[model samples]
Target chain A: MNDRNRIPIIITIMVILLIMVIGFTSQQRERLTPVEKWIGDFFMPFQRIVSQGYYGVEDQIRTLIRSSEIKQENEMLKEELHHYQSELIEAKLNREELMELKNLQQTLNSIDRSGFSEPITANVIANNSGNWFQMFTVDAGERKGVGVNSVVIGSGGLIGRVYETGNTWAKVISIIDNSSSVSFRVLRDGDLQGIVSGSVDNELSGYLFDPDAEIIVGDQLITSGIGLYPRGILIGGITDISTSADQLLQNIEVEPAVNFNRMNKVMIINPKIYEE
Target chain B: MRRLFLGSLFFFSMIIESTFLSYLPFPSLVPNTTMILVICFALYYEEKNGAIIGFTAGLIKDMIVGRVVGISALTFMLIGFLVGYYNRKVFVENATTPFVLTAASTILHESIAFVAVFLMGYPIHVTMALNRIYLYQTIYNALVAVPIYFIMNQILHSHFLKKSY
Candidate 1:
């Protein structure tokens, strides 16, 4: 073909390509299949290498600047460490009491523990940087019994759920992701169900459908013993609420107790497999 | 070949921006670097190539971040096409011009994104969105513009620009 004719043809091809991209992405949103999982896994090593390199440099610079300060702080921390040790014991006691209370509630409610499986621990290897959502890739994969729909929990509470899982790695769709949803209940109240959705601003907030539901600002939100997550695990606390004029339901905002920004380790809870 | 290279570069930049850059404690409410570099490339390259690269980069972003499809693609394509057309008309071959072009393009790109989100039936606070656009992110992108453009330009020149049309 002549050069002038070729230009128009190229433009046509580009337009066609653009349409194809839009169509493909729409399908991707609905289902991320095995192929997509493979691609994500294929790219995992590269992502890890780049993140490690960047983090190594940053850590080096930080260590250099903070070495002296760290030493002085260490002595002061040692003094405070004694008090912290005592507080740790009290905290452990409180935690145990909370767990016992949770167990009692489970027994009262006749909650099924058969589906609860041992959790797999994984290290966060990378994080999403530019996007408003908070996401991380973990080292555990299919080999380690990590699969899609697995629940990830950090120190404070639920962090996210696994969206994609591969043979050697998995990508977590954080609770901070706009598409993520968690079924939760008010721990202080009995049998109130609500859905916790993520915002574009990387904040975990949700709406309570029941206007009469007894929910307060500091009330703890826990998984509702339904859907992909297990019951009795802490999610976060209700921070703000706005009641509509009609007052059918309240617009509730939750502040996730989990410090996702500083999260390094996570426990991936796999659903139990039963044999007939 | 040029298109492929530019597309890959933009993809890589987006990956780097989302993974590594997000962690740094910058003096801004929201820090972003991928769109800025994509805008710079769009300003320098041909219009069609610019749009293609922008679209690809935006697709990768949506895939990773889980936004409704076509939002970033639509926004970046518009930014790239306009910037490319502007570069064709006005000869911007200096250091300062690229920086200025990036700042202007970043603002336009971000506004388009804001509008796109708003139009998608999502609840958006105009004041909060405006604050993010004008003060925090705009300044952050402007400050990072020079260095990012410098690196991107070097890579483009070496890998793709050398093969002249």
Candidate 2:
């Protein structure tokens, strides 16, 4: 009866369980586990507190060490003030001119969201720590109409798509994740299309469909409107481009428009744009 | 009580890496603190304890940040068991032991994880992942492990003090 050498049985069971969990999670797009949602929501407030403190400290440090930047900002503010003062005098002279100005501004803004609805804003509460996967949790979720596949954009350009959401928190898998890929074209030439993919280095690189596309460094890239992302979201500028080893496709490196490490706020594209 | 302490310690360490260090300006070099804890714990205790700690830490991570669960759990558990299995063979007091062990463990973990992910059909570029990402990660972990080892030794002086000498 001393044959109770049971360590192997336990290890085997664990291995089998792990494989099953992996299989289940990998195939799931959203609601992979209620456990994940509960844990994410439970710790969200704490993560928010930490992010706020970090933001406060960062603002202080930036103001302290950025005298040159502050001076530039001061100059810009002065210019803005002067411009506004002139606009005010002009407005006093002609009320109709002011209405025209308002219309022009609205028209320009409409182009940015012409096909989209008003975007919902969210705060990034937590980010993945190590350099493994590019992901984070935002404070807006299903309660705010944020659902899986909602496009997230920052001040720069396209951020990523929401892969999971809870009541008050949603998880975003950013475009810079190695597993994420986007179809894009050179904004300079719409015919020059390529696939921009993320890597473990947290960098963006892609390959062009045509080897002779005549693209160059510093050329802007935008979504080609072929995939989950809508057309015209600025991806980034090409930093380097060279032919692949086989020379069939042009390999290009990109610097994403948004700095993933320092992102604070993001906007989620509303799903109601098509219907309305 | 000891289990509670270790559990909370693992939780905090996990947060420090994923939340705090992640927000840092130069977070590229942030060490894997939870993995470090698992390695140290395995070294300080039995193989069974090591595997258990590793499994728990990895499971929590998967629940929090992992896209697919079990990848981290399997790799981290293996690391814990291997380290703990040979815990008594190496002198813990030697300043270089942690540096060496951490470096090796990180390499092993990254390689196994990379292969696992690739096999699972994620579109990762191999040369880029190995050259640009995991290399830096391994070096950074080894560097951080030195100071972390001394701190852990200080906290659990009684258990590991004799083993080091």
Instruction: Compare the candidates by TM-score and give the number of the best one.
Output: 2
| Residue pairs with clashing backbones, model 2 | A129-B18, B93-B164
Provide the lDDT at B66 for model 2: 64
Per residue, candidate 1 scores C-alpha lDDT tens digits across A1-276 of 764346446545654665555455532142465654665565667666776677678778988999999899999999999999999999999989988887897889876444556779987766752333346777788889876778899888898887766677777877876667899988987478788887666678788868788777898989887777777789898899888788887878889978777656789987544100
Clashing pairs in model 1, backbone N/Cα/C closer than 3 A: A129-B18, A130-B18
What TM-score does chain A of model 2 get? Answer: 0.81
Model 2 misplaced stretches (Cα beyond 4 Å): A1-5, A77-115, A129-132, A189-192, A207-216, A243-251, A272-276, B88-92, B132-134, B157-165
Worst ten in a row by lDDT for model 1 chain A:
A22-31
Candidate RMSDs in Å, in order, are 5.9, 5.8
Interface RMSD of 2: 2.2
Docking class of 2: medium
Q: Alpha-carbon error at A234 in model 1, in Å? A: 1.0
TM-score of chain B taken alone, every candidate = 0.80, 0.88
The CA lDDT at A43 in model 1 is 61
Q: Each candidate's TM vs. the true structure?
A: 0.71, 0.82
- Cand. 2 Cα-lDDT: 0.80
Q: How well is each residue in A105-131 modelled by candidate 2, as lDDT tens digits?
A: 778875433467678899988786345
